[model samples]
Target: MVLRAWPLEGIGEIRPGDDLAAIIVDHLTEPLEAGDVVVVTSKVVSKAAGLATAGDRDSLIDAETDRVVARRGQTRIVRTHSGLTLAAAGIDASNLEAGSVIPLPRDPDGAARDLRGRLEDLAGVRLGVIVSDTAGRAWRIGQTDIAIGASGVAPYLSFAGVEDAYGNLLAVTSPAIADEIAGTAELVAGKLDGQPVVVVRGLPAAWLDSDEGAAALIRDDDGDLFGLGARDAVLAAVSRGELPRGFPVADEGDDLLALARAGTDLSLADVTVAADGSLEVRALSEDGAPEAHVEAGALAERLRILARALRREIVIAVVSD
Candidate 1:
C-alpha cells in the first residue's frame, strides 16, 4: 500500500479565534480524499485558542502539571492533566516569539473533531483528524510527533488474540497507529518549514473511526511500569509522610548519610552530601530490588524532616538507573 503526506502551505500564522478549518480548506493545493487523515500540529491549535501566554513560565508549568516525574538541574519531566507524561507538560518555548510559550490545546480531541467536521463539510469527504505534538521517549534520545488528540481515527490498533507472521498468538501487542501516522506525517512537516498541517492518505479502512480519541494512548499509572522516573518515584512516595517497613529512622542517626545502606539489603554507591545538605544517591538496577528507591525516598524524606526540625538543610538523590 502507498501513502502520501503533504503539509498545507500558506495557511499563515493562526491568530486567536481564527477559523482553523477554513484556513486549511482555503490553503488546500489539492482536495482531500475519502479516508484521508488530517494531521494538525498542536501549536497552531493553541494559537487559535489563544493558549499562547506570556505568563510566568514557572507558574504556567506548575499550573499545567499534575506531578513531577523527574528533575535534574534545569530539565524536568512531568505528567499533565491530560494523562500525558511529557517534558514540561508539553508547554513548549519554541516556534513562538521570545519571552512567550505555547501550550497544547486544552481539548485537542474536541479541536480535531471540530476540524474534521469543517473539512468534511467543505470537501464533502469522510476523513480522520489527528492533533499531534512532539514528545520525548523514556529510554530513547531525540523526539517524535505523537497524537495528543484524535478524532475519526483509531488511536491504537490492538493485536491481542491475533496471530503474527510466525503464527504466534499476540498478547500485549497493541500498536499506537495514530501516533505512527502522526510521526510519519511529521517527516514532511519540518520544524522551521512553517508547515503545521499534513494530509496523510492511504491507511486501512479499519484504521479510521468516528470515536476513540488520543486519550486511548495513555496508560493508567497503576499499570505502567515506568510511570514514575526512578528518583521522582521515590520523592513522591516519600512526600506521603511515610517510610518503608524496616527502613531507617531519623532518631537512629539515619540522616541524609544513612541512605547508602538505607534499604535493609539495598546498597547505594556514590552517596555524596553537598554543602547545602543535598544528596546524590546512585543505585544500579541489578542491585537490590529495582523499586527500592520508592522506599528509599520515603526513608530520605523522613530524615529530611528530622533535619528540617533541627534547622538543617537536607535533600536526597535516588538515581533511577
Candidate 2:
C-alpha cells in the first residue's frame, strides 16, 4: 500500500559497458528490500545493452520492425523485434547523437532477469525488477510508462469469479498491475530529467514472487477479440492495433456506417437506398458508385433515415454500361 519512488540522476555517463544495476545501487541511499520493485526505463537498459547504432533513423526503424501496422506519412506503428507494437519500432532518437537511434533491448524480460540477479547478488536481497517504456494508448492522450519486462513480480492481478459488494460475480477483473506500477514510477522518472531509475516500495507483499515475466501483460494475438482483420489490421497494424476490436460490428447498416465514421473516413454518398425499400452500400470507392438496381432491405431502412438526412441518396441506374 505504501508506494515510493526514487529518481537516480547523473546517469548520462552510463555507457554500453557500464554496469547499470551497480550504478543504480550506488545512487540509492537505502538498500532495496525483498518486496521492493525497481522500475528501470527501457532507454537506460538499451543504452547499457548497446542497442544503439549509427544509421538512418528510418532505416533502423525498418530494420527493427516485423511489420508496419499503421502509417500516417512518415510516422508509423510497427511490431518490433521484441514482439511489441510501438511507434517507430521503439527506436529512440532523443538523448542521443543526431544520426544515432536507440532500439529497445532485444529481450526486455531477459534484461529484467539479469538486473534482478545482479541486484540480488549485490544487495543480498531477493527483489523484483521491471523494465518500463513509454507508450501511447488508443483513444487516449499523453503517454505513460508500462512494464515491458519484469522479474519476481506478478504481471496482473486477477479478480475473476470474485464477488462485488453486491455479491455479483466478476467475470473479468484482471488488472495490469505491473504496468500500473510502471506508470506510477514514471511520475518520479521525468522524461528529460535524467531520472532513469526509480525505486518502488510499499507494494503488496503478495505481488513479490518468481514466476513468468511481463509477458503475461501481452494478450495472445489469436485469442484476442480486439485482433484486427486483414484490411483493418493493414490500416491500423501499428501500435496495439490488436486491442481495439471490441464492440459488435455496427449492425450491417447505419450502425456499420457509424463505426466506420469513428474508425475511418466515410461520406454520406457511400450508402444508397433502392425503390423496394432495401439498402445498398458501397463501402469502398473501388466498389463503384451506388447502383439503382440494388434492392433495399429492412436493415437498410434503419440506415436510410440517416443517409437521407445526409443527402447520401444515389440515383444511378443498375443497368451495366
Candidate 3:
C-alpha cells in the first residue's frame, strides 16, 4: 500500500548508442528489489536508441503525427502514429543538443520490454519498466509525466464488478497504475534535475507480473467520446473532410433532411428528398439571376459535405431554372 521512489543521482550524460542498462546498474545507490518499478524518461531512451534526428522540428512533428485532433493558433494537438494524442507528437527539443530533436521512440512498448529484460539480467531481479513522457491534458493546465510505454506491469487496476463497503457495485473504476508510477517518479526526477531515471519500490507483487504493457491504457474510438475538437468537427463536417473513427453514423436520409432544413442557403433554392433517396435541388430565381447556378453549386458541395459527415452516399439531382 505504501510506495517509496527516489531518483538515481550521479548518472552522467547519455548519448547515441549508450548502454542505458549498464549505466543504470552502475549508478544504483541501492539494490533493486523484485517488486521495484524502473521509470525512465523517453528522452534518454531515444538518445540511446539513436532516435535523435537533425531536421526541421515541424517536419519531424509531421512525420510522427497520424492525424491532427485539434489546432489553436500555432499549437496543434495531434494523435501520433503510436496512438498517443499529445502536442508536437511528443518530440523533445529542449534540454538536448541544439540543431536536433528527438521524436518518441519508434515503438515505446517494445523499448520498455527491451529495457525490462536488460535490467532484470543486470540487476538479477524481476522488475517493471515504464517509459515516461511529459504530456498536456485535455481541459487541464500544465503537464504531467505519463507512461507511454511499459513492460511486465499491469496497466490498469480494475475495480469493475467489485462491491464497495456500502454495498455498491463498482462498474467503472479502473486506475492506470503505470501512469501513476510514471507521474510519481516525475515528482523526484524533475525537469531541471539531471536525473532521468527513478526507482519505485513496494508495489503490489500482483501488479508486477503482467506483460500487457501500456498499450492497454489507450482507449479505442468506441470508448473515446472526444476524439476531435469542437471546431475540428465543425470544419471537417462543413468541408467534407474525413471524420475520426469516433464519429457516429447517422440514420438514412439524415444528411438530406439536415440540408433541406438549412436556412438562408435554402432561400434561393428548393431542396427535396425524393423516394429514390436522391436529393432533388432546383434553383429558384425568378429573373434567372446568374447567381442561381452559383448558389446551386454551393448547395451541392454542402450536400456532399453533409453526406460525408453522416457516412452516407448522396446522389444530387439538380434542376436549374
Candidate 4:
C-alpha cells in the first residue's frame, strides 16, 4: 500500500479561540479523501485552546507531572497526569515568545474528536484527526512525534493469532498505527518549518471510521515494563513506598544482572538465583558479632521488601562468620 503525506502551507500563527478547522481547510492545497488523516501538532492545539501561559516553566512542569521517573542533572523524565511519560511533561518552550510556554491540550483525544467533526463537515468527507506531540523514548536517543490524540483512526493494528510468512503464529504483534501515522507525518512537518499540520493519505479504508483514540496506546504502570527507570526502580524498592512498576515475577533462567548494577554495596556473592526462579540472598556481613548480625538482618529485610515488590519469591539467610 502506498501513502502520501504533505504539510499544509500558509497556516499562520494560531491564537486562542481561532477556528483551527477553517484555517486548515483554507490552507489545504488539495482535497482530502475519506481515508486521509489530518495530523496537527499539539503545540498549535494548545495555542488555539489558550493553554500558553507566562509562568515559570519549572512550575508548569511540576504541576503537569504526576511522578518523576528519572532525573539527570537538569533534565527530568516524568509521567504526566494523562498517563504520558515525557520529558518536562510534554511542555513546549520553543518557538514561543520569551517566558511563555505551551502545555499539551488537557484532553487531546477530545480535541481530536472535535477537530475531526469540524473538518468532516467542512470537507464533506470522512476524515481522521490526530494531535501529534514530540516524545522521547526511554531507551532510544532523540525524539519522535507520536499521536497524543486521535479520532476516526484505528489506534493500533493487532496481528495476534495471525500466521507469519514462515507459518509462525504471531501472538503479540500489535503495531501502534496512530503513532506510525503521526511519525510519518512529522517527516514533512519539519520542526522549525512552522508547519504544524500534515495530511496523510492512502491509509486502509477500514483503518478510518474507527472510534479508538490514541489513549489506547498508553500502558498503565502495571502493564508497562519500563514504567520506572533503572535507578528509579532501585530507589522505589529501597524506600518501601509504592513500588513503581517494571519489576515482574522472575522465571527460571532469568538472569537478574540488573540487580548487580543497582548501585548497592552488596556483592554478587550475596545474591544468587535458586534452582526454582526464586532468589537466594545472603546477608551483607559475615561476622559473628551481634551488631553484624543485626546489620545483616536489616539488609535481608530490605531484600525481602524488594522481592515482595517484584512479586518474586526470595530466600534470605544470614552469613556465618
In TM-score terms, candidate 1 sits at 0.77
| Per-residue lDDT over 87-171 for candidate 1, one digit per residue giving the tens place of the 0 to 100 score | 8788888878889988788888888898889989988999999999999997899999999999999999888999989999999
What lDDT is reached at residue 278 by model 3?
85
Per-model TM-score, in order, reads 0.77, 0.72, 0.79, 0.78
Error of 4 at 52 (Å): 0.2
Model 1 deviation from the true structure expressed as Cα RMSD, one decimal place: 9.9
Off by over 4 Å in 3: 244-321
**Prediction 2 global C-alpha lDDT:** 0.70
Tens digits of per-residue lDDT, candidate 4, 267-314, equal 323555557655554544444445545544555666666555445565
Runs of candidate 1 exceeding 4 Å displacement: 238-321
Residue 87, model 3: Cα distance from true site in angstroms? 0.2
With candidate 3 superimposed using the best TM-score fit, by how many Å does residue 157's alpha carbon deviate from the native?
A: 1.0
TM-score of 2: 0.72
lDDT comparing candidate 4 with the true structure: 0.80
Worst 10 residues of 2 by lDDT: 245-254
Q: 1 or 3: which has the higher lDDT?
A: 3
Write one digit per residue (lDDT tens) for candidate 2, span 201-289: 88887888756898777766666564433334522322113443212222213243443233322442334446864444543434444
Q: Which is the better candidate, 3 or 4, if ranked by TM-score?
A: 3
Best by lDDT: 3
* Poorest stretch of ten by lDDT in candidate 4: 246-255
